[model samples]
Target: MSPATALRRNSDLGAALAEARAAYAAARPRSAAQHERAREVLPGGNTRSVLIYGPFPTAMTRGQDCRLWDLDGHAYLDLCGEYTAGLFGHSEPRIHRVLHATLEEGINLAAVGQGEERLARLLCGRFPSLAQVRFTNSGTEANLMALAAARAFTGRGTTMVMRGGYHGGVLTFPASGTNAATLPLPFVHAAYNDSDEAARLARAHAGDLAAVVVEPMLGSGGCIPAQPGFLAALRALADETGAVLIFDEVMTSRMSGGGMQARLGITPDMTTLGKYVGGGMSFGAFGGRADIMAQFDTTLPHAGTFNNNVLTMAAGGVAMGEIFTPEAAEALFQRGEALRARLNEIGRQAGVPLGFTGLGSMMTAHFRQPLPDRPYAASPAEEALRELFFFDMLAAGIYLARRGMVALSLPVGEPEMDRFVAAVGEFAESRAALLRAGGIAG
Candidate 1:
């Protein structure tokens, strides 16, 4: 398979580590005590496992510019970038002002407001594919609506979930559902871009698959962008099989002006968006064809109490207006290229397999050889190296996703990128010295 094809694939990252010692050491005494106290009330001392990293997670105080300061007062250049949602960075002055103004107008009245309609209009205008939109409070809710619409429109229960594809942590697209289910459910587990395989799976459940939901770019599963033919093939298959093609752009929307689907020139029947939509406020949305989206009006169960909360709409509107510029998106892509180039050059000098590649604004560094487009199902050693590199990166002051994806925001520019590149250089140098003492893997 081509590198792009393999990049559409997913690898097994192995385990959730507990950097208890490191996490403990990193926390201030009061913060550490708070963590200990919370364990009694909050399970695992937190609500979400995704938020808690190995050892324990840091207690964040606040963010400004492109940096985060923990409760212990240790400041780290924010590279996680709020999982790629804080496109304009934390507490941006202009966005804050807009939101503050919205608050003065009253929060909500249990009915649609001009703010909601205006935000939706801007979203639809910027994304040509989103002709009509419904605002939801979370990406999962947006995806749920998309899936329900597909099922309602197509009258099929089964949805084709790409193997290892994550869609808002939904069971309809669960990690194990693709291969293990037995009935009219998420019955297909076709690997990305394998037209023949997906073709076979669709035929096996002939006429039963309502939709084929895919992430144009995998966010949680190692930041792997789909190969070119992959999404095109899915689009074709959905048409042939009469299945709804839904692109879950929740996490991948930051990739371009219209998101990864636009970057790749692939359009689906329905597209769900979130993350950046909130613009650092809580928000989510899904939009598509006028006919298909008519399902939203079908009086089905798609309502949420805080669906289009006024605050999210106000801030997201301002954020969308500012961020949808050609200059801003282009500048972000350029920064991605510069960061990757510098990192790879240092990788060469340091003798590590460290390299970065991505489409539009998304990018990630790998500790192994230049990866193929498919999930190599990385061997045990390769997986170990990935984990070791994560901890090493932490030791070097760059906190990246344990999975290795290094998403960037508009605020992250030359200085931030340079600091990040330098960290990679130091990692590479130390890693190479270690390898020289032993040996290096391709």
Candidate 2:
């Protein structure tokens, strides 16, 4: 297209986005009020950056089953699933019972609890990489400790992470420099799923590399699953270099009974976990071969006051042992696959630039013109579509991340999935003019 034509198209797209923003603000008067009130106490009216968006974020009142009610009295089918932490949904009966029982007994015993051991045992039996484990307050801590352990074991100072990876709050990767949160540790950022480049980096940093940390599937970085070959290559490189391979399964653990490591049949030296593993509580864990984890001896000292608290242990025990069993997880995975297939079909039928990337119950929609060769490296067009889709989906009563992430929980079923699909169809129809003008859809 010529410069004048391109300029006109850009101007039109900007106008449409402005209109959508206005519509969003007008629809959520109560949310806007709540955000204004929150801004007085909380910076930008948000504790989490991702939860904050333009015009203001909606203040959710309560959640039950698979639905969330916002301050505006707008109810939504929660496809974001609290970014995969709400795997058990808002109110899983088993989790509620376990938590209540634990609360009745005691919260912090101020010592090592038997419940921790029980949960640990269950985790060890399920995840082959976890021969022994240690608990933490959040996924960030789990990753921190895991990296520390790898460094201690290898006596090295450098760690390697993927380009678009996000291990935790501070462990963010190469974003637009808009966020300042990050680990101070020396990190060699490599491309996701590019085994050759990663292998080269690993070999180059061979002697000093302490750990090669990665997500089996990129969770916050657009829900892209690692190609099997890429994972296997990393495993081989770790073996060759004597570096500990740490799989950050904080989000991907919900993929199956044994998590993605099991499903992929590739094991890592150490694994970090969080999210629904705590049975909807604040939780994180790191574990690996017994020999490596054994270094957590008193001499080395890994300390956290609430690391082995009874509440998380009690709830987690029930979450893994009873609630999200292998059978249940398998069923959920199947349902997710079906939902994803249907969504892709709708996109194809509508001739939209919409696409999805993920595995099992986790997925993210992308507005790639012809879909991306890799999820991490997205075009500007894809990014713009993601922003537009977020607003459209929210208006349609489907709560998802602005990044287009949609995570499925056990409480969601066929009816909810159907409704979500229909909403996507409607959004496509309504936005056809804008989408076509921007070359985002037919």
Candidate 3:
């Protein structure tokens, strides 16, 4: 396209985005006021970085059965699924019963509780790699403990992590550089899904490498599933280099009963889990081969006030043993697979430059064609176009992450899925020219 034509197209895209932002702001007066009040203490009126977006975010009041109501009283079909922690949805009857029963029994018993062992056994039985397990308050804490254990066990300080992989808050490694909040570990970065580079790095740091941590599917980095052979290559490299291979399945654990490792038949030395496992409560777990986890039993120290809290343990037991059984997990996986296929088909039929990438029950929409295999492989998403899409989806009564992430909850049935699919089709058709002109098709 000529410079003048390109400029005009770009100008049009900007105008559309501005109009959407204005509409979003106008529609959420109460949420905006709430944010202003929060700003009195919270930075940018936000405690979580991901929750922040331009024109402010809609402050949600409550959710139930895959539906969320913002402070402004707009109800939405919740596709965000609390970033995958709402697997059982906002209200699962069984989970609620368990939580209530546990609360009645007591909380923070200050001693090893009865509920912990049962939940631990269930986890160890499900995941092939987890011979033993320990709990934490969040996935971030679980990863910290896993890395600490690996470093202590291997007697090495250097850790290898994939670029664009987010294990937790402090363990994030973006494409360009480490996030400001990242832990000061001796982290060496490697590209996601690049087994050869991973191999080279492992060999290079073989002597000092304690662990090579990765997400089987990049979660916060765009839900890009690791290519076949990539994870297997890491396994081989870790064995060769004497480095502990830790799979951060915090979000991807919902993929199956045993997670991606079991599905792919490639197990890691350690696995970190959180999200949905606690039946919607704050939770995380780390476990692996008995020998590695044994250190925690004696030499290494693992302590947390709420590690064995009755509420999480009891609720988690019900979540794993009753609600999200292996059969249920398989069914959800199939449902997610079908949903992703349908969404991609819609985009293709509309001739729009939109795509979705992910594994079971979790996906991210991309406004680019020829979807990326890794985060850095493609240019950054067109923010204007992405924001426009977000606003449009919200207007259509579908709630998803600003970054286009969608994590399906158990309560999200055919009706919710149909509405979401219809909304996407509408967006694709209405904004085809703008989407095409945003240089996403290339």
Worst 10 residues of 1 by lDDT: 8-17
Q: Which digits, one per residue and each the tens of the lDDT, describe model 1 over residues 306-357?
A: 8778888778877887754656776787777677777768867766566665
Q: Deviation in angstroms for 400 in model 3?
A: 0.5
TM-score of each: 0.87, 0.94, 0.96
lDDT of 2 by residue, 130-161 (tens): 99999998999999999999999999999999
lDDT of each: 0.71, 0.86, 0.90
Better of 1 and 2 by TM-score: 2
Count steric clashes of candidate 2: 0
In Å, residue 90's CA in model 1 sits off its true spot by: 0.7
Q: Note the residue pairs that clash in candidate 3.
A: none
Runs of candidate 1 with Cα error greater than 4 angstroms are 1-31, 171-185, 376-384, 433-442
In model 2, what lDDT does residue 296 have?
84
In terms of TM-score, the best-performing candidate is 3
Candidate 3: residue 222 Cα off by (Å): 0.3
Q: What lDDT is obtained when candidate 1 is compared to the true structure?
A: 0.71
Per-candidate clashes come to: 9, 0, 0
